[model samples]
Target: MYLFRLAMASLANRRFTALLTVFAIALSVCLLLAVERVRTEARASFASTISGTDLIVGARSGSINLLLYSVFRIGNATNNIRWDSFEHFAHSPRVKWAIPMSLGDSHRGYRVMGTSAAYFEHYHYGRGQALQLAQGRAFASDPFEVVLGAEVADALKYRLGEQIVLAHGVATVSLVKHDDKPFTVVGILQRTGTPVDRTLHISLGGMQALHIDWKAGMPAQGAGRISAEQTRSMDLTPQAITAFMLGLNSKIATFTVQREINEFRGEPLLAILPGVALQELWSLMGTAEKALFVVSLFVVITGLIGMLTAILTSLNERRREMAILRSVGARPWHIASLLVLEAFALAFSGVLLGTLLLYAGIAGAQGYVQANYGLYLPLALPSRYEWTLLGAILAAALLMGCVPAWRAYRQSLADGLSIRL
Candidate 1:
């Protein structure tokens, strides 16, 4: 009890240094926890973005690339799969439903996805949840009609029956605009916290109509422009699509369908399990994740080192105080234990402060994170792995405490009594 009081008095006397040390440790702990949380949640969000689909089929390309463009609205596809090829697999006995997707167009800045009404019926995200309309309904058979994602509607302040023009290419701003064939917003989707929320949905026919006046990817100077009324009577069938997503009738058939698509003679095609492709994509980012983890660990070690420095630096000024204690019957081991206790107290306090800061920050930014990044960070207790990390931190603090404790133990009676300052 006496040693504890003396240690508390010593820390209070140098409260400024003690406070700074605690703050350093707290910030380090916050960063370590934040990095791990974001890493875990980001990967989970990536995986859950498009679920319930057995495989994603695209032109022969890297699995990660296909997953990126098809699901995440990332880079352009190297080549498009034929519409007929999509039909062939979509009708197979082994397949349940295949959702065709055509890309390479944009409205304002959001991506315009050419798909079918079947998309609303068949496409699922975040565990078999079907797409639902928050207002209005899905697009009809008309090629001039379009549906808006929840974010598209909210961000652009669009309403049902509003007319919007699409750009020729996928750029945020395009020189060539399809102004003649404006689409009526027929539907607004409910928020899914996925890529679906960021996409503008249109029929495959609409996609073909947008490019019908073009030949070899450039608009013909004198090409005939078709009116919206004329587009209905014209052949609106699509020639090729960027990709397609398939849901299989049986999980056992996944490998068989994958093999069939890889060896497809109709066109150079590729198919991959969505889960496997997601893993492949994440593997590309594994280095960044590891780097963050290593940096966080270093920050923690640095914080502990700061605490050790503060305690060791204070020991010299306290040599006379220590000699007085020795004269009053205090042992060197008691002095050593006092330093250890002070170190543990600082560490424990820092840990608590850091944990509270982490949770508070997470709670405050949860909505913004989901709105911008489509990542849902759960406000749950520390995970088992986190507990292990905390335990390791505690153990490291104790080990560091031994440093100043040993220094104090080595001090002699004469050394403390002869201190000048």
Candidate 2:
């Protein structure tokens, strides 16, 4: 305890340099921890993007491609499955529930998804959590009503009862739009930290109504244009849809139902287990994630190296101090122990400051990140792994402190009572 107080007093005498070293280490530690937290949370978020569904059925395509378009909403589908084929499997005894998805429309930059009321009751994410409305109610029999995702509503400043037009394609700016058949926003879903938060949802009937007047890829001619009200009286059953998700009555029957959907004679359909597909997708991104972690680790090492340099550089100027202590009954080991204590002090202070900085950053940016990127960064306590990381950092600092400690011990022994300067 006496040695520790002596070491702290010595550091206080050089407080400017000591503070800089602590700040450097704190920044590096903060960065490393931040990267690790984001990597872990992102993986968890990715895996939980869609859950409680046994299989996802779509037109035959690469599993990654299908998963991308269906769950992540990343790209367009190669082909859409016939709605009748969806009905064929949806009615099977093995199937418990199905949610059809009709994509390929956009509101502003957000992709528009056409689904059924069943979607609200069936679709789930993040540990089987169902979608909740932040405002108003789901689109009920009205074919001209739409639902906005939390992100879409917040970014575009939309409210319930507001009229909005959907474009023909997924482009940010489309020359062709369903302006003549604008729909009223009936609801806005709560944020899910998934692709769903970036989507604009509408019933399948509303989807069909938006494109009902189109001929080929272009809008119908002036006389052929179908009014929104006129289409309300017409059959709005979707002809085809991008993809659909299914839940099985029995987990044991999952493979059986998947096989049946893939082998359906009605169309070339593909069915994949959501869990398996999510794993495959995460594997593809693992390399980049590891690279980021490595970069942050290197930054921490750089900061520690700076600390080692500072200590070694100060040893020359403090040689007289060491010699004086040696003459005044202090053992060489005491001098070495003092140096070790100083290093530990700097590292421990950095760890504390880094933790504070991390929490502060998370508290400040939590809402903005969730609103814009659909990633929820929680301000929870550090996990066991994070504690292990911090322990390793302090251990590494102790190991590094040994180098300067040895140098100071040799110098104090050699220059017993002599002042070089």
Candidate 3:
């Protein structure tokens, strides 16, 4: 007990150095926990984005690329699936419903997705959950009505009845705008923490109406832009769509239906299972993930190295203190134990403090993240891997503490009653 008091007093004496060491360890702990949280949440978000949808059909391309473009909105599709292909798949006996997606436009930075009301009816995420509107209503009767994702509404500060113009193509700045045919925001969706939160939903006819006067990727030479009121007279039919999400009548016949769609002679298309495509994507990205983990490990090692150097540098000053304790009848083993205990206590406090900081950040940013990205930042209990990693960190700290403690023990024995500097 006396030796413990001596160790505590010793640490309290050099408050500045101890605080610095604690902070370094805390920062390393923060990095490790943050990386673990991000990696887990990223996989969770990806998995939840396409849940309950059995298959996705798109133009002929790599399954991973098609999934990345259609599901993640990360890339562009190479080709468009013809309208006839969508109809064929929709009417097939095995298919319950199909949601055709037309991309290539944006309102500000938000993506404009043209689809029917069927999208809000069938889309699911995060444990087979369905879409729910948070405010206003769906585009039931109004062709020009639009629905805003939580992110789009929050980021742009748009509300019901606000009118906005869609830009030509997906460029950040567009020379051509559909200012002539603006759409009204009639609905706002709840936060889902998926790409859906970042999307602008409009009717298929609205998309067609916007591009009516354009041909060959530009306005027709002799065509004058039509007014919003005059658009009612023009034919608004979509000729192509980027991709389609398919719901099957039965999960058992999913492969048979997929085969039918893939072998369809009416149009060229490919059907990919969302789970399989996501697996392929992760596999392709595995090298980068592994590299990141390796980097985090190196950071931890560098921190531990810093910790050791700090302890060794401070040992000289502590030697006189140790000699005083020895003169007061404290054993050499007791002195070594004090050094080890100090190291262990600093490491434990650092880890605990770091975890609290991480949770606080996640708690504060939870709403913003869900509203903007549709990712639910839950502050649940620590995962199994987190516990395991924490245990490993504690064990490593103990090992680091032992090195200095052992050296101090040897020196106390050699010096006996004499003081060594």
Report every candidate's CA lDDT: 0.88, 0.91, 0.82
Return the TM-score for candidate 2, rounded to 2 decimals.
0.93
Query: What tens digits encode model 1's per-residue C-alpha lDDT throughout 324-388?
Result: 88889989999899999899888888888898999999999987786567676889998887878
Per TM-score, the best of the predicted structures is 2
lDDT winner, 1 or 2: 2
lDDT of 1 at 395: 85
Q: Give each model's clash number.
A: 0, 0, 2
Ranking by TM-score: 2, 3, 1
Q: Mind giving the per-residue lDDT tens digits that candidate 2 earns over 1-421?
A: 9999999999999999999999999999999999998988888889889989999999998899999989988899999999889899899988999999999999887899999999999999988999999999999998988888888888899999999988989888888888889989999999888999899899999999988888887899889999988999999999999999999899999998888888888889999998999899899999998998999989888888888999999998888889888888898899999999999999999989999999999999987887666688898999999999999999999989999999988874567456656
Model 1: pairs clashing at backbone N, Cα or C within 3 Å = none
Better of 1 and 3 by lDDT: 1
Consecutive 10-residue window with the lowest summed lDDT within model 1: 219-228
Residues 52-78, candidate 3, lDDT per residue (tens digit)? 898999998889888977877767898
**Candidate 2 vs candidate 3: which has greater TM-score?**
2
Residue 7 in model 3: lDDT: 66
| Whole-structure CA lDDT of model 1 | 0.88
